[model samples]
Target: MTNPRFDVAGIGNAIVDVLTQTDDAFLEREGLAKGAMTLVDEAQAAAVYDKAGPAMECSGGSAANTIAVMARLGAKCAFMGKVKDDAFGRIFGHDIRSLGVHFDTAAAADGPATANCLVLVTPDAQRTMLTYLGASIHLKPADVDLGVIKDARVTYLEGYLWDPEDAKQAFRTAAAAARDAGREVALSL
Candidate 1:
């Protein structure tokens, strides 16, 4: 009813990306599917990360990246995603907030650690990804802020959120709130 306060509200997995340069031989040695994104567990993720070469880490995710870019472009944006009260979680929160994106989802106190995506970039610029959903999959409907959704001109949902039932419900809740407020809903496939 009132003027929207934010241009976009995004919801998706909260992930810290660890990127490393590797060769095809490294991928083959690690038994990684070349240029494919694979879902892995925490231990597996750690194992791969331990073996990776010098790397760079940063906040990353489909919707989160979109929101970050929108904020950088001077659009008021808000983001909702799950994270743990761990190092990576702190980095994620700090990175998004520093970019001027509003993010206030509570961190899980006792669950798994924050999520991370290991992106192995080969010489040809092909990316082989190993993603550990971790705490990001713990997002539930309660994490969806109705006020933010209702106050944003558009609510964007990422397809990755559908992988987790709870996150899926949160996405639905956000979509409903935006629709009820006469706001637009966008989905990233």
Candidate 2:
């Protein structure tokens, strides 16, 4: 095969992170498990957001973060994930693209809002996270770009993506395409 067009192709959730500074009491009051990542529903996520202090929002996700770092390090990278056509979705796409990572997964026209994580940081520097999967969990096999997978030297899969059935199928599809193209498949646990 000809030389690969990209060094890595990453597949995983597309999430916007909202970080806030708070004390341990706040965590206790909110019933949040300090220093742990917990899955929350949309309502729960909103409740935490509403009750949190000043926050900083940014695009972040396991695979997306890895791809962003790789791109900054001069690696040609691509990312595949699902997001809704909402404000957070726009932010995620724009941020990743600005980092020189190719991200062309179509945003869902009608679905739950874009995924988000509420990160509460205590004085101790420990972070407690509440994540709402939302649209990110809607990634289906069709969302996986076979060409991107085949043209990347490595296809990276995020462990969290396996929780959703559709995303799992998409992950499998990407892995199969990479294997078929004689490329390596890497998983981040």
Candidate 3:
């Protein structure tokens, strides 16, 4: 029986990556660390943005990024991740759907805003990320969909999602569900 779900499903953060090019002195002056994904709170997110110059907002999240590329390569895809039902979240959801990926994860209608990341790209092209999980932290085992697991050929995940304990639990549940469905589970650091 053909599963009526999808070929690829990913569960991770739903973030808008703000990328900007800077020099080494810029990082030191701003008290920012380099080349690591640092978890931040909303205030820190704001602080980073206030300091950063012009940036380009791109739809991103570790697993989400991989799924996006896979989709661009024409792989059938689906993504399950939490987001605030606010503007940024809506835009991320729309972008994925436009690429023909299935997304049915419920958005947190009354929590923190959608997640956002500050991506500082140096002249050397090395990237450092500071993230605020925001509403994406609400992801729990209950948020995972068993049907998506059944239909997808691969279930992909990102390690960064483990920042919040609930989300970590959700990842475990999703992986177990995918295993039960005989689907491949891919994990990326």
Candidate 4:
């Protein structure tokens, strides 16, 4: 109803990615499929992390990255995603906020830690990923701020959000709000 407050509002998982370089033989030995994004549980995520070589951590997630890029290009944007109140979670929050995107989703007090994506890049430049959704999967309808969605010119939803029921509901809520407000909605496949 009021003047739009942001150019875009994005909703999806908040993930931290650890990327490392490995050879094709390493991928085969580890039974990792090349260039595939596989979902793994907490234990599996940990095992992959342990087996990975020295890595660099970065804030990553489909919609989250999109919002970050929008902010960097001088587009006002907001993001909604769930994380845990832990170290990696804090890092993710800090990184996004530092990019000047509005991200006000509260962190879980307990439960699993923030999500982690383990990415291994082979010599062929193929990336094999294993993701543990973790606390990011807890994003719910309540986390979607209708006001923000209404105030944004467009509400963007990420395909990965559908992987989690609560996040899927949140995505739908945001899309509905955008529609109700006569705003545009974009869904990334």
Candidate 5:
């Protein structure tokens, strides 16, 4: 029998998307590999932003995105991630909480800026992401809120979270907690 305190939990990179419509030539000029997520530093990320046309910002992180969709359906959710003390970071924080999801990770006072991904939707709707992991790299096992994991019936994680050691460990921590509580774990592709 499930404890049933909550419906679900999720974990993934805490990222914001800066979307831009671009051409293949632009990708070639920027030396970016098409349809792939390449890691870039703050300087490179800024440079790309400058080259890209007017962009729209949105709260998105793999696990967070899944949680967002679930929340839309009136399901309860929780998340774990790291952000900075900057404006974008605050925006990410508020949006998640406003949706009634619990986010308990502390912000890194001085590190890479909040994780931002440049999502390029080509004319064909093909999406290529260039990401700067930023403070999200700081999310560790300690950030995994075990109490929430124990309460939820289904805990969803993103496979891409494996890209970060800390996030991977955080998922492991959450997974362990879920198993201990006899809950189900699902990895979103």
Candidate 6:
């Protein structure tokens, strides 16, 4: 057994959120079901991005956000997820790292771009999400760093990762490592 190096290790989708403010009319015009998350392909993502007005891009995802918040609260955390060597990917990696969270997952050189979530917030404060999984879906068991998992006091997992077989394997690996180390594993549904 080794000394824990991190308070938590998170495994989940690495997504970049493109938030935009819109009205019900705009949501209806875009054929979006308000307040629901819909998965989109690359072409659909492009169409939505084109239709959306000015947007604010930020690093986001279920467990990813959890790790960022935990780190901000002064908890040592490590994040494991996949991204591409593209603009959004770079930004996502940089944002998490800048927050003092350890993220050493390798970026895919040749693949889809980083995942993008088009979050449309309406006047009622309700959000509608359109997501393109992109390279984040490429996360595999190999990306799960056993050392980081075992060295963390807890491992956090996101249920969204279940959509991808590889990512699901990575999540299981991390959880197993944490369990073997007698650490806690938390799942965010």
Clashing pairs in 3: none
lDDT of 1 by residue, 31-100 (tens): 9999999999999999999998999889999899999999999999999999999999999999999999
Lowest lDDT sum, 10 consecutive residues, model 5, at 1-10
lDDT of 2 by residue, 44-89 (tens): 9999899999998888999999999999999999999899999999
- Where model 6 places Cα greater than 4 Å from the true spot, the runs are none
lDDT of each: 0.94, 0.94, 0.84, 0.91, 0.85, 0.91
Candidate 3 local lDDT, 1-189, one digit each (tens): 466366688998888778888888888897888888888999988887898889987778888888888888988888888888887788888887888878889888787989988889998999988888888778889888888877888888888787789988898898898888788888878
List pairs with backbone clashes in candidate 6.
none
Model 4 TM-score relative to the real fold: 0.91
Each prediction's TM-score against the native? 0.94, 0.94, 0.84, 0.91, 0.85, 0.93
Per-candidate clashes come to 0, 0, 0, 0, 0, 0
| Deviation in Å, model 3, residue 175 alpha carbon | 3.2
* Model 1, residue 82: C-alpha shift (Å): 0.4
Instruction: Give a tens-digit lDDT track for model 4, residues 11-52.
Output: 988999889998888888888889999999999999878987
Q: Once superposed on the true structure, which residue ranges of model 1 sit more than 4 Å away at CA?
A: none
How many residue pairs of model 5 clash at the backbone?
0
Clashes of 3: 0
